[model samples]
Target: MITTKDLQHLFALIAADIAAHRDHLCELDGAIGDGDHGLAMDAGCEASVKAVAALDPAQATPAAAFNTAAKAFLNAVGASSGPLYATAFMRAGAAVKDRPDLSDEEFLRAFAAMAAGIQERGKAEPGEKTMVDAWKPAADAALDAWASGASLLECFDLAERAARQGCEATRDMTAAKGRASRLGERVIGHIDPGAASAAIIIASIAKFVEQHDSCRIDM
Candidate 1:
């Protein structure tokens, strides 16, 4: 099982992944949004890393680490995304508060809380072509997998696939929210910046935790 330390490392790996692919994300965003996705993501991830670094991982609760990352993103990222993303983390942290090792139910409930936070804060629904489009499905699938007594790794895999599919779904959708809406028909072919970045963050963290867990099992 992934512990609080793994949670901390997850954000660190996500930060590196975002840094490595910042230009590509910006390029993707340029097709529809303001083309600042890469820059925004980099700023957010850097803030997350600094926040993680500042924490005492051994002492900080899982929720505390998550809250710290969210707060940093809120302060460091100067964009609409920071607040929404922070809300996701805040909700997730609350879901898993004080829990060192999450059971299947805890994991799913935490993800569900994040989805609720997104819905409440963004007020966007499925098919709105927003980050919610990607997040809602992924969270649902993770919840389903967890509810079925699947492993945490399996839950992440399910959510990862759902997220990618959700991101792809955005490709054919006309923009209805965010800067992409300003582009009208021209936005039909590009992925949403928020969805793409969310996918990157989730998938990278999953891979990082999986590798670390495998290493521990092998040992």
Candidate 2:
């Protein structure tokens, strides 16, 4: 089961990871974007984690934490990623509304919902050299692993792996959406900053699950 505490920890890990990779993400964006992707992601994640952390664990549900994070992220980031990730967290909150904790299945559903929300909000698909390349594959991998009777940790591990691969694959893809789209073939050979950040987010989830031995769920 994943409690609000776990969700809070997850966001904290995400914020830390994003901050640590800020320079790398900015460099990637410099290849095809305005080079502010890292700064936006770092600020948004940091704000989200802080907002969630301020919640009282005794009263905060997982959904509430997600909602709080969503609002903070949106308010902190003025870039396109702001709305996209805010929508993702909102959908994740909706997926487990009213729940104080989440079962493995509920967690998977929320994860998938986040990806779906990102796709819907951004109107981007795989091969678009965008975050969807990472998010969609991570969600799919989680679902597939869960369906195969994997533990929550295993499922998230697979998700992280898929997200990383998707991020790497973006290096070979031409931008088909966002400002990078205007670059045409010039964007190829460089990984998408959005995809890189998405991978970091997914990996944070996996890392949190791994560190917590109680994160397992019955299949």
Candidate 3:
């Protein structure tokens, strides 16, 4: 089972990973966007980690942890990406509401809910060169792997791979959404900054789950 403390650790991993890639993400955005995607994502992740870390893991449920993260992220980032991710976390929290700890299947469901929420809030579908390109495929692959009886670690591995592939695919797609869309075919050679960040987040989550496979907090 994954506890609230485990969730906290996961958030930290994501924040750290984002920090590590901040410059690269910004560089990618500079090609087709405002060039501040990395900075915005870093701020949001830092805020989310701080807020979630402040919670009492033993007392807080997974839902509470996720909701806290959502609020913090939204508060930290005012860009369009902020609202998209806030809705994602909110949907995740709702999916796991009332659960003290999370089973593998439950966690995957919450992950899927996050993707769904992003899709709804962004009004972007796959191939739109949005973050949804990465998130939606990753969620689908992870959930499908879980359904096939793969271990949680294996499911996450699949998720990371799918997210990377989706991110890469964006390089060839004409932007159909966001600021990049205004660039028309000029965006064809550049990967979407949002998609790149989404892949990074999924990779970090995958690593977290792999590292914690045998160790759990508050369990």
Question: If scored against the real structure, what TM-score would every candidate get?
Answer: 0.92, 0.96, 0.97
Cα deviation of 151 in candidate 2 (Å)? 1.1
Q: Candidate 2, residue 90: CA error in Å?
A: 0.4
Q: What C-alpha lDDT do the candidate models reach, one value each?
A: 0.81, 0.93, 0.94
Candidate 3 residue pairs in clash (backbone atoms < 3 Å): none
Total clashing pairs in model 3: 0
- Alpha-carbon runs more than 4 Å astray in model 1: none
Native-to-model Cα distance after best TM-score fit, residue 181 in candidate 1, in Å: 1.3
lDDT of 1 by residue, 1-219 (tens): 556677777788989989988998899888887788899879988998888787776788778877888899888887778888789889989999888766546656766787778778988888877878778888888878877888777888888888889988988888777878887888888788788887787678568747865887799
Report backbone clashes per prediction: 0, 0, 0
lDDT of 2 by residue, 1-219 (tens): 789988888898999999999999999999899999999999999999999999998899999998999999999999999999999999999999999899878988999999999999999989989999999999999998888899888999899999999999999999988899998898889999999999999998888878775534333
- Which parts of model 2 have CA positions greater than 4 angstroms off? 214-219
**Global lDDT for candidate 1?**
0.81
